[model samples]
Every structure is written in structure tokens, then in C-alpha cells.
Target: MTQTEAAPVTAAPVDAETYAQIVQFYSHHMQLLDNAEAEEWADGFTEDGVFAQNVKPEPTRGRDTIAASMRRGVDRLKGRDVVRRHWLSMVVADRVDADSVRTKYYAVVFETPAGGKASVYLSTTGEDTLVREDGRWRIRHRLINHDGA
Candidate 1:
């Protein structure tokens, strides 16, 4: 008798309720950033959260540091007349455990100058680890891998 290999088993997908919650969380997250609400954006993270980008070698640790970093970016754009928007697509969430989830999504950043058409500024894929803190889903870590970077 010949032995046959078994097909790979995949993890169960997130339920619709969980998926909707995550979507709402992400929507609020992006809106805060787009509106330059740095502190509020940071509040979406845990106290010891991490944020990293492909271009940066070091990750920003802690919510305070993350908020400051976001503020700095907002400051740079203050006088530039540029409106930045983050578009997320193809978000897939997997349950890591009872109170934690891992998500992968595609992110596209668009920039529209005053009186100008919006154009894609950056495109990247992101992996995020989210944990339930204080009965709300908060980002524990986020790693953004820029396309071609």
C-alpha cells in the first residue's frame, strides 16, 4: 500500500462579528491618523505597543513614543497643503487566541495637494497583532512592509 500525504490544514477564519469589530477598529484608527489626531491614534494601541516600517530599522516602542512620532509626521505635513489618506484592503484576520488576533492587509496611501488630484504616495502590506485591552481591541504591534522597499 502506498502512503499518501495529507493536505495542509488551515486555521479557521474569523467570524463575521469579529471581522466587523476589527473593521470598525481599523476605520477609527485610520481616521484618527488622517485627521492628525496623534494622541487619539496612539490610544488605539496598548501601553507597550510597537510600530515599525520597512524603511526604518528600529521600531517605535510604547504608546507615548508612537504618539510623538505620529505628531512629528503631522507637523511636517502641516504647511505642505497635502492631505493624506490611508486605504486598506484585503484584510484577513486570524484568531491567535481567545483575546488576540493576527491580521494582514494591504495599505495604500494617497496624497492630494490643495486643488490637485489625489495620487498614490505609497503602497505596502501590513501585519498587525491586536489584543483585547480594557474590553477593546488594541494594536499590540504593527509592521508595515513597503512595496519595493
Candidate 2:
């Protein structure tokens, strides 16, 4: 093998119980954001978690910054009396290590204004790094790519 090419690492697949827990974790995590519980949603991340979107120039790093960003979006939507719902599906996870997993999922967000019909607001696919911390799953990093972008 060439020195430049790295060898693959062997790791066990995430167990059934652990995989189920991860799925459940995403249910609550996405709901928190959809409900505009910015602070609470951010609490699901590690202290140095990162959030990145393809449309954005740079990823937002740190739990505090991520919370602040969510708060702003929540406030803006609330001002317009718009409610957002996130529908996440097609979750696939691969174990990176005993404590970390890489997840890929599809998310579609629908928004409804106070007096308007619901419409699709955004469609994206995301890959994230999740870590088991203190007996719970927390996002270590997230990378989202807009379906159109």
C-alpha cells in the first residue's frame, strides 16, 4: 500500500439497542428545534459542537454560538407567526467507534403562517457525528447540504 493511502479501520456495527436509542434521540432533538426550543435544542450538543450548512460561508462552532443562531431564526419566524415542522427520515448510522457514530438523514421542513397554508420551506440532507456522553447521545458535529444548493 502507498504511504498516502490510509488503511481502513475495523469497528463493530452499532448494536440494535444502541441504534434504537440513537433513533429516539433524533426524535426529541428534531422536535426541540421545530418547537423553537432553541436553548433546549442546543443543550443536546456537546460543548464544542459544530453546525454547518452548505449555503453558509463558515460553520458555526461551539454550543453557545449554535444556540444563539437558532434563537435568532426562531425569533424571526415567530415575528411572522410562522410555525416550522421538521420531518426527518431515512436515517442510516455507522459506528465510528465504541462511543461515536456517523449518521445520514433526510429532513424536510414545512412552514405555516398564522393565516396561510402550510408549504415546504426547506429540503436538506445531513450527515452528523454523534457521541455518547454521560450515557446520552449528543451531536458532536453536523453538516447539512441544501437539496437545491
As for candidate 1, its clashing pairs are none
Off by over 4 Å in 1: 1-10
Candidate 2 residue spans exceeding 4 A from truth: 1-13
Give the Cα lDDT of each candidate.
0.90, 0.88
lDDT of 1 by residue, 3-85 (tens): 36321223656789999999999998999999999999999989999999989989999999999999999989988989999
Worst 10 residues of 1 by lDDT: 1-10
**What are the per-residue Cα lDDT tens digits for candidate 2 across 1-149?**
38664323323447789879988998898899988999999988899999999999999999999999999998888888888898878877878778988888899999898889999999999988899999999999999999988
The pairs that clash in candidate 2 are none
TM-score of each: 0.92, 0.89
Candidate number of the best lDDT? 1
